[model samples]
Target chain A: MFLSFCDGNGSALGWAVLITVVLGVAGCAKNYVVLLPNDDGTTGKVAVAGREGVTLLEKGREGAAIGGPAGKTFMVSDEQIAEDFGAALAASPQKPVSYLLYFKAGTDVLTPESQADLPEILAEIQRRPAPDISVIGHTDTMGDAAENARLGLVRARSTAETISQLGGSIISPDRISIESHGEKNLRVSTPDNTDEPRNRRVEVTVR
Target chain B: MLAMRLLVLAGAFSLVVNVSSAEDAVIGYVKTVDGDAVVLVAGKATQAEPGTPLQRGNVLKTGKPGSMGVTLKDNTVMSLGPDTELVVDEYLYSPSDGDLKLGASMRRGSLNYISGVIAKLKPEGVSLKTPAGNIGIRGTHFLVTVEAKD
Candidate 1:
């Protein structure tokens, strides 16, 4: 049975050993985690800290048993993943999309290009079910911190207002949250009193 | 004298209310649901639907055939499968102040998690606690399943 588990891969022997050990201790309910690839096809790492030690999972579909010793990992079959996470996977919502709408210097007015992109932002919100939006405004570092904060809020409020007006019945006023990051969060890093166009913008995220 | 005392008591009560309201700002919202999903707030269960607000310390649960999806303010996405019970133990997402944390505990069932700005900015701050062990997120996607203990 252990030999049958090996698929002639370089790591087959190690996997067979792990599978044998896993089967030997199958009394308790199985608890585990699987590393999956991101939507963009990039893989990241997860560190599972068990009672014994930590196990780092770096490959897609790679899994490790919870509450067990570290260094014990095996590839989770697609069927097993389907059976275990089918509902959670199915319940996954559409990924949120973000838009950076640049503003005119020291003003709440949107740049011409950003104004043209408003419709696309509206379409993204309308595409989702029960969509909610967050408009976070930022300002360049050319003014006083407190004043920039107020300016950021003004920009955010204006953008949110425009979005609500364009969305009309599709968007509820309560679902839109507006905040200001001010000079504290600049898109382009610059010294104090330096003007940067990219830093003066409103970020809209539709979820 | 009694009226003055009552007025002072009311003043104190309003202060407490304001503090709590500011502290418990909405951290996320339910974006999708199928069948019987509920969010437990202040020990009371409310049927969850799209646009339902989520606060820290709330419990998200699903029935035998239920499932739910939520998106946090930082764009972190999470979905729960049937018979799942997840608690948002802590959440702090003030990027300007350099405060970013996301922590949750899963008692049972499955969860699909996608990293967001919190994990991207401070990977050490994101964690998912399970009955058996804890998982540290590092700006990626993963799935976890914790079977009920016998």
Candidate 2:
């Protein structure tokens, strides 16, 4: 009986030692940052400035403790990531989408093709929950700066009105914001008095 | 002459108000909420819901089972997991004037961040502060989890 008791105690100590080692290695630090690939499958770098030093993360799934010793990183497994960030990832909102609606030169009227694209914008607006949009108008450098500013505002306002009219009850009027970038923001850079068709457009971003 | 002077003074006052109000305009909106969350503006807590407008200096907090997502005017996307607290300390998005910035702080909890126009235009202007350290984003998607201090 004395020998059996001693054997049982030894086994228990071995199991405890194994469990402690596993836990120490697996749960080293709870505070850390992970780099994720962009929707396009391209990865970017992140610099974490910690107390000891800075660590740069460039590859997907590469992670480092926020309070780091620079250059120290580990690969986070998919299971661990899901357990840690499932809620936050699941709660991410839909990414915003932008559309460029071309306008007739010197007017707020949409081009024939742009007019047909209005339905698509309306569809997107209806698809989102509590959606908001911004209509920013841009003008070519063909006119005076002040005049272009006014024209840009006109285009933005008219485009917003069209979206509201088509969306009806799907979106509230207060949710649509209008701004005018005028000749300052040009899609295609050109000298003054140059007529660039691409520059004369309104950008609508649905979020 | 006295009436004209008073009118001028009133015009100046209104102009100042207009400029200040423009600065305090809504910078983003709460796009998604699950479970329980609140947005604290000027220290006053309001239950967060879809369409809730978020201004600068707002603190977003979530309960144990809560989650929230927000999309800023510049298209930056952020989501917070349960028991999380984040503050939008500063935001300046005026691309026409070449002014762009986004500064935020995460006191504790998990966050999912996706870069936006501001990051693309001015990469150095964006920073996320955590208790452990500061994160300098170079226009990418990332996840952060800050454990609560005992």
Candidate 3:
């Protein structure tokens, strides 16, 4: 890293002082980060300066590195990053959340694991102050498109019923939204009539 | 010695009050908190509560076994998972005038981001800086994780 910054034009005193400060700062980790555009070709730039040199982050680069003219520079990509950005400022939310649940073959019943997972899902719903649940059911390719679509709705209703049972009055009719995507949106890609267990499922999003 | 420490703390407290008055503005609120979380403002760590207003330059920290969720004014939803630090640097949103920008830094842990009105209005306006590099958003949802440092 120090090699990148050494242009061979600095006095000995300047280099010594820079090295000292760099070592002092590097004793603890402080990363600097800058976000770059993703695969769509949009772009952003990140640069770092050390005691001896500066490095402009090349596109598609990511890390927590140290070394430059100042030797205190560390740069990394958004793929994996952590860094302090600035001085303290006074600051200060409710955010929505979503989840998915999957189903069994040729039936509106939730798969065994999903059935077992019901209590936790119900708990999450109850935790939210005003939860709005959106449940969508889907089926694998084992039947006609129309039948599968109807089956999807059946599955969704079944799940809603379970939620109502678990939550009692807390899970209200008005707050529950049910929809179906029977065979239309397969969790697993397969030919017609394929019994992909993964495709038979329901998605529950709570906000 | 104890009295001296208290005096120092009082000075710091007054300094924080002065700084907050100049630049703090609510841009979001904590919707949920699991385990332990705090809002670091003007170098002070205050236990974060649901509905705590988030302001510019506030660093958010979540302890082990802790997580926090927030919703920005523009509806951007962000969730931080155990052992994370995030700082909001700059944010501006004005749909009518086509003005929108968000700048933040993440130090560690995981962050789940769901784009809001600002990103939908202008994708180029949002950016997150990390030690590894910057993340440019082009999608409505993104889940990013940064492992704990030694």
lDDT of 2 by residue, B35-144 (tens): 98999988899999999999888899999999999999999999999999999888999998898999999999999999999999998999999987899999999999
lDDT of 1 by residue, B29-142 (tens): 999999999999999999999989999999999999999999999999999999999998889898888999999999999999998999999999999999889999999999
RMSD in Å for all candidates? 4.2, 7.2, 15.6
* DockQ for all candidate structures vs. native: 0.79, 0.76, 0.05
Query: Which of 1 and 3 is the better model by DockQ?
Result: 1
User: Model 2's CAPRI class?
Assistant: medium
Best by DockQ: 1
Residue-pair clash count for candidate 3? 31
Residues A155-192, model 1: lDDT tens digits: 99999999989989889998999999989987889999
Error at B40, model 2, angstroms:
1.2
CAPRI docking class of candidate 1: medium
Ranking by DockQ: 1, 2, 3
Native contact recovery (fnat) for each candidate is 0.92, 0.87, 0.05
The worst-scoring run of ten residues by lDDT in candidate 2 chain B lies at B18-27
TM-score of 2: 0.88
Q: Per-residue lDDT tens digits of candidate 2, residues A86-171? A: 99999999999999999999999999999999999999988887899999999999979999999999999999999988888988
